[model samples]
Target: MSIPLAERIRPKSLDEIVGQSHLMGEGKPLRRIIESGTIPNLIFYGPSGVGKTTIARFIAENANMTMYKLNGTSASVADIKQIIAETEMIGGMNGILLYLDEIQYLNKKQQQSLLEYIENGKITLISSTTENPYFYVYNAIISRSTVFEFKPVTPEQISPAIKRAFDLMAQDIGTEVMLEEGVVEHIARGCGGDVRKSINTVELCVLSAENGAKGELLVKMDTVRELTQRSNMRYDREGDEHYDILSALQKSIRGSDENAAIHYAARLIEAGDIISLCRRLLVIASEDVGLAYPMAVVITKSCVDSALQLGLPEARIPLAEAVIMLATSPKSNSAYMAMNNALEDVKNNGPLDFPRHLQNKHFDGADAKVRGQHYLYPHDYPDHWVKQQYLPDALKDRVYYEYGENKTEQAAKAYWAKVKGDKNG
Candidate 1:
């Protein structure tokens, strides 16, 4: 079969590569390193279709080193050893560049095997991972290498390469290739920041294009739409994207941005990750919403139950309700904060005793060493509430549960202030 368009149009030089402006732009770290003509042991990290491999190939072409590509998924320690064994061969006369893709898959021992060759400068190990390298690649490998993250391409950044793909195809066919209005934008925006996916979309459109009356190719929006029906949502459920979405969801709710909260919830819904979605929404109700709206916990619980029973795409309704409710509701972390504060004291103080008055004991004679412990009963008082030391003696003055500023907590504060009079609230 013929080479795919994305591969056929792979960037031949640093200037041709698109996206990762933070690293690839003029005077950026990667550009400076490239200009210096020294390829260090490097780890290229981030999501797929983000040009990690393309840059590695560019380094090989420029460095004059024999590049041996080994995938961590299938390559054994023996494969690594064989590559190292080539260091003395004529192929290794200049230098050896080992491009190990999916470096996360290699066991620590397999990765350990590369340290000797790489440390001695015989093998320049350029590794790439779709997952976060910090969690996957060995720390030793990490310490010896300079890590550069390749980010997703924005539609604006990748538009030039998409135009190039069209121009290249037109040049080959010896005729003009016309793209329908919005076709480029659709392909660029829909491909989820993957350069290869965007290029492949263009190729498919061209293959399915019609011949115009002027002997030119005409690519239309309908073809682009059909080709990219499932392209927009791209993320590894096991990777950073998943956690980032979850974190964004909670933060948006905490910040009371209903629109952003709804948007992130919809993305997770599209991914069909109902479990994580429901769990995070529930946590937000308590951790973020807290006592500001006391009923949020119950309502969120009910919505989550409904979502679990109903399942998506039908479950999105209740899930959206819960998300919006938490986002728009008055927010307070008072309860969450109070629990944390109490926990800190418990941890730091070490084995604090509950006040004898608060301990569970029967009124029988054997219970209190036959002494008058006199734990006053609050029920005998006027309001069925009376001031007493609930905290241990050391923490008697340490107040933990402070009322939040929202109406709900302030009302409770007012009632307590009335009940407790001049003593406390």
Candidate 2:
């Protein structure tokens, strides 16, 4: 069996590494640390394929230290103790680096076992995680180590690496290799800033491809597409990304950007989170497209019903239509704002009694004249409409439901003003 192209081309020295210029650039903190040959107890945090594990290997190799690698998913406290004991047997744990991948998978108890080894300097622990360490890693472990964040490798930085992979493939196959124009660009973009994924994609393409008439391995765009599926869509269905995408979708609709709104809706549809999509759309209808387009809420509900009946793949159609309708509709948040403001006042002031006239007359022994004192019956008046005190005495002057600026709201606002002789009534 041959070594994977990604492993074969892995950078042994920091100089050979591509991307992560922010940390690996000249005179950068990481460069300075690695060049000094003094590795620290550190955590490398970032997205996958951005060279976190590679960097750890480079650190251990560059420092001339004996390194032990462990997967946190499989490594138990006993395994860690055994590794530490091995280091102890080899003369008191100096110059020993332990690389633990997926460190966030280790529970608090498992994490606690590392603290003693780290505290005593028996082993330099360099952990890598794809999640935000501050949220996932143990506070004690994170506090003791320096954190280096690895950013996504940009297209320009990753392009040369793709070419390097081509050369490596040619060497491995003993033939000249050729790639169609834009193939490298396409892979780089599709890999979503993951260099490892891009390299593996290239390797897969070359391995699966047949030699051309001239015996040269020619990789075409379609071949690349067939080998490499769509770009990695970074989303955690129940994590921060869930709320983030929902916020983006709602904001895009509220901002009336149809393209952006539809794009975000597609993300939710792709994730198969129909319930979240429905909930967010309903909210957008009420909170964003309120009285300005009252029918939007009804349309969104209908779409939700259609999505439920149709289910995925086909469900995306109704979601897209709802996104487009909400995105293009006139927006007003007056009703939402009114409810929120009223809620705040109610919360602060405690419960207020209902108006005397509004109280149930069906209650046994309830008086209409004395207790309901001066309550006028609107049915006896012309137009069957009357302006009477609805708000509690304390909030009589408080205006919560001010009409928004839109044609529909303006018409309603005008009628209220005419009926009550006050615009805010």
Candidate 3:
């Protein structure tokens, strides 16, 4: 069988490559490197289907260099050595540009083996990975290579690419397929900047319509949505699914939906979003649970720290625990509102000067001036309650934290009320 449309139409030159104008545009760093004929050992880090491999090929072609491509997922250390040996044989004639895709999958040992060759300029190494290299790649290997981050193809770019692909296909088949208006835009949005997936979905729609004897292919929004849902896994790191999952997580916590929260947490963890999952849980504990269940915040923090230290699989346990704790805790937005209200007061009224009597007096003769002044130490008073103006003068009577009715906060409120009455009486 012939190659797929996406592969068959792969850009052979820089001019043919889509998107990535930031790097391929005139006077760009990558453009300069290619023009100078002195490409450095570099790592292309970014979201998938954004022309990482295509850009690498453009650079290799422009420089008139031989390209040696390898998938780090399937290749072993022995495979790397063999490629290197072959490159060295032709080293004196024309240099070889080694393109290692998914380089983050390489273990430390294999990564270490590539370091010498990269640094010594034996191979102009160009590696592409969808992961953050600092976390996944060996530090030694990272230090040896210049890193270029590629952004996902934006909707503006994807629209034109889809049109170009569709137009080309129509010309080849000798049939005019009228793409429904705004259909390309919908597909672009659904793809979340994944160019390959967008193009493939368009091809699928066209093929389906052709078989059905439809002269005009109406690629509806629903069709695009269904294609995205069916073909793509729903939790990509840099895709819309990431944001969707995050939103679900926050809503689940806010609504006190423990089951839903845990489900969202599982989805994030499965998609390798451990850090985001832990961070959101920590925020939920403090902002949503707060003093209503103070232990929730403590547990969440402990989980975050432990997850960072322990890393994956094992780390997932602590994250799961924190998610459960945050979800099940007494739900309250008191602390979140309190901070917001306090910040609003500050922004509107400006910084309030500290009361002269309450100001720090470390200098000589300053203590006497401050002593026996307006300041009242709440701890020293009966019931530990002295209702001095804690808020600034502009917000003196403003109340932000509405204590929740949970057992823990109710008790705290009662204790504070007794202390306030006793000290004032």
Q: Which candidate is the best by lDDT?
A: 1
In model 1, the runs with Cα more than 4 Å from the true position are 233-251, 272-425
lDDT on C-alpha atoms for all candidate structures: 0.86, 0.84, 0.77
Q: Give the winner by TM-score.
A: 1
Encode model 1's per-residue lDDT on 1-425: one tens digit a residue: 17778888988778888888899899899878867778899999976788888888878778888899999989999999899899999999879999999999999999999999999999999999877788889999999999998877888988999999998877766878999999988888887677887888777788789999988889988888988765544432332245567889999999999999999998888877787788788889999999999899999999999999998678999999999999999999999999999999999999888766666864556655446546889899877778887888798899898999999999999988888995463
Q: Which pairs clash inside model 1?
A: none
Residue-level lDDT of model 3, residues 1-425, one tens digit each, is 15667776677667667788888888888878878888888899877788988888878887788888999989898987887787657552477788999998888898888878777777888998877788888887788788887877778888877887788777767777776577788878777577888778778767665323556555555666677655455425433235556779989988878899889988777666687787677778888888788888777898899998998778888887888778777877777887898788788878886554466653446445544456678788666666766655566678877787788878988988787767667
Worst 10 residues of 2 by lDDT: 232-241
After superposing candidate 2 on the true structure, give the runs of residues whose Cα lies further than 4 Å from its correct spot: 91-93, 230-259, 268-425
Which residue runs of candidate 3 sit more than 4 Å off their true CA positions? Answer: 12-16, 90-92, 210-222, 234-298, 301-425
Supply candidate 1's per-residue lDDT for 220: 83
- Model 2 agreement with the true structure over 200-227: per-residue lDDT tens digits: 8888888877789999888888988866
lDDT of 3 at 319: 86
RMSD of each: 9.1, 10.8, 10.1
